[model samples]
Target: MSTGTIITGLRHRFRQLNEKPLRDDLIFYFAIIAVASVLFMALPLLTGEAAETDGMHRAWFIVAGTLIVLVQGLITGAVALLAVSLVEHFFLLFVDVHREFEKTMKSAVYALAPLILFSRAVLLGVSFAGLLLLAWFCLSTYFGVWIFHEKSKDRAVFVALATDAILAFYLHRWTVGPWLAL
Candidate 1:
């Protein structure tokens, strides 16, 4: 999608039930991961720890390190996306729901925008944009359940909290956390 579309997606949280569903194309999804991974790699430079890590000061080392971080972050992010989707779907199973897994995947997909677009600012100790982005992620994920599946607000909130907990406790370390620490 274009930059305008992405910005609009962020503003709308990418979960408008009145509109068409999220595109089922894997390429579009992975493209988000790729861009996020690139942005993630750049975040560590703010602290200079990325260059300091394993003597990455040299130009060649920087190039190689960037490629490695990009690949690792991409893989980890994809796996997290799948895992979170499954978890969210599993939670929804308690209700008399009959939605496809793609619905949950769509919810999880929108949550990434907050992290990928605004997380660096949070890590950098900037303004409150990060918190808003995070709220956007969680709130969108909650609303997405209502739009895509049952209208169980409680279950939706639980799914959102669970998703955020997983990110904070587990997936964060594998994906963007390392970059922030580097």
Candidate 2:
């Protein structure tokens, strides 16, 4: 199919998901973020960072990590809204959803505006590593959705998550392990 068809289909799926309250979306986003958070926490341990040894520090770490994941979840929620809008507009050709492509794209760009905050955070901060990972993962997930709009969402998400896992594992072993002497 053409690129236009793919975009339209994604927009349709997005609208379908968004026909509910924000809370439902939040729940889904948070669950994904929490799983990702656990993975993030585990990474430090794999490198012998001792996050598990200090109970007090680990408690504080979890609190801070949870807040960061929550924020990342909020960002994903916003991106979902935009993707839904775009899918509706683009795919409306197949199953029209009362909106123009230009209008939808404009709205999507605005909806994705907050993602820039994440880039800024990555550039300026020395802390909140787990949050950074969550932000990057969310961004990657959305981009994967857009790129693989022709596939079932299950396949697309699986493709994206698998790619990320492999890349992260390799990078951890090749780059981080040597630095940390693990």
Candidate 3:
């Protein structure tokens, strides 16, 4: 999916997906993680903060750190995908919608388009727009779920929204809880 589709919503992305069943969604997911990791480091570098290390060359440290972040980001991202898809499926069960795991995965991965361009803004303390993107991300995922189960509009909305609420709460806690404590 192109960057332009992020603003168009999950329905458009799913249409593109249906047109191209062979597209590799994992690459999209990893690309988003990469973008996020770069944003995570961008502020520090821009602010002239140094990458302090114990006798390690600064360049080497940055390279090594980037590699570590990429790998760790992939692993963590995979776990999150699985967990979210599972939750999406569980929510579908309540509505008697038996969507496949891969469909839910499609919903999760394509919904990540919002994060690709905006998550860094949030992490960098751009609160208002980032919060909008965050809400968009949540809504898109639920919308994707509803799209997958087209037969039950009301039930789909309920299950999808409930699932999103649960996932969003846990995600905020895990991702921001430490900073909140400070």
Candidate 4:
């Protein structure tokens, strides 16, 4: 699909997060995750200092780097899916919402469309844009959860904050920590 089509689809999905039969669309969801993961993983190559190595060494390095990016991307995507599922489950405890786990997870993943698209700016070191994108991500994530729960405005805000915090902590521990070690 075209970029415009994807963006339009995401916007439509965002608006209808509260409606019935939330589309799982695993193919699209996984595609977004894959693209974001690959792009994020390749940021180092795009912005890192150039090495003074020979041809073979460079080739090997590129191959190794590509493999690493692919593997990490898949892992990060899977972790994110699981994280959303867990967060939704935890939130359901206090709230009286009646939503299916799979639908909730789909909402959570689809809501990340903007952040995934904006991630390129963050990876490119646009600090101000990155910060705005971060805020947008948090807000979108909150809305996603709110749609599923149909809770009060205050409760929805709380759920969003709690979900973002939990997701940030989990991702930092699993994804960022290891990346920083490299």
Candidate 5:
């Protein structure tokens, strides 16, 4: 599918989420994520690095990096989906929601599409834009969960923010701790 089509579909999905039934097409969701992953993987190359490098080394590096990114992105995406599913399931126990587990997963993935796209641009080196995008991402995530849990909108936002904070803490601890020690 074309980029325009995908963006339109995502916009429609988010806009009509309350009115329409949740989509059941796993393949479509997978395609969206895969395309996002490819874009993310290519960010470095497209921005400037590809122009900086020349000859065989550049070719080899691109090939290797692309493979690594593809594999890592898929793995990370799968793990994240699983985590979201589990978290949703846990949340469902206390608060009854309209959608099922799989449907929730689909919605969450759909919500992440914009985030994935914005992150690719950020990765390409726009710090200020990245900061703005990050704020947008957080708001979008809160709204996404809020929309899903119609009866418990406040709870949904709380859970989303809390989990995000926890994730950030862990990421910072692991990723920055070693560098700081030096």
Candidate 6:
């Protein structure tokens, strides 16, 4: 009940979540987002909705598009990190001490099932409009992390921004060209 005890508990939980497998998973998810972001960048370009169309114009669009992709990479990275933090807190309630971190990670993966579907729904219905963003920010920040981990204040924000950037990049490239068959 002391502030120091709470901080210690939070730190322990954070370390547990950042173990080897969990970190690997986090990295993998960010890579997926990075690829997806490139696709997203190509969308407006292929459709000819990009700000510039002519030779000089195209050059401008390319520069702007690249910037967007980079931002996307940062955002998705943040999402992966946020997911890990949320997983940690949610798992804490269901398991014993030793299992807490792993359970949290698994639970976070499960949580993404709904978030992905929901985000798709939002995108299909409205694209990347402000309203959908407002909704995502509200949900991912307040209900997602804060409710579960009382100490999740900083984690939710930093992770969300990073993941959003990564996802944006993934989407940008996929929109632009032929998919690399893997």
Best by TM-score: 3
Note the clash tally of each candidate: 2, 9, 0, 0, 0, 48
> Which 10 residues in a row give candidate 2 its minimum summed lDDT?
106-115
Model 6: per-residue Cα lDDT over 60-124, one tens digit each: 77877777886866586567646555544543433222334543443354334334334433544
**Residue 73 local lDDT, model 1:** 72
- RMSD for all candidates, in order, please: 7.1, 12.4, 4.8, 6.9, 7.0, 14.7
Residue-wise C-alpha lDDT for candidate 3, range 1-182, written one tens digit per residue: 88658646656666666444424777777788877776666557667785655455777877777778777877877787777778877877787765567777777776666655565665556536544655676677766776655535577567667766776687674445546867
Higher lDDT: candidate 1 or 4?
A: 1
C-alpha local distance difference test of each model: 0.67, 0.48, 0.67, 0.64, 0.59, 0.49
Q: Which residue window of length 10 is worst by lDDT in model 5?
A: 170-179
Residue range 6-121, candidate 4, lDDT tens digits: 75665566567555443444566677767776666566667776455668997798777777877786676777677776786677656666766775676577656666656677
Query: Could you tell me the lDDT of residue 143 within candidate 5?
Result: 55
List runs of model 5 lying over 4 Å from the truth. Answer: 1-15, 18-29, 46-65, 92-99, 128-134, 171-182
Clash pairs, candidate 2, are 8-90, 8-91, 10-87, 11-87, 11-88, 12-87, 12-88, 14-84, 92-96
TM-score of 1: 0.65
Error of 6 at 82 (Å): 1.5
Alpha-carbon error at 38 in model 2, in Å? 1.5
What TM-score number comes out for model 6? 0.43
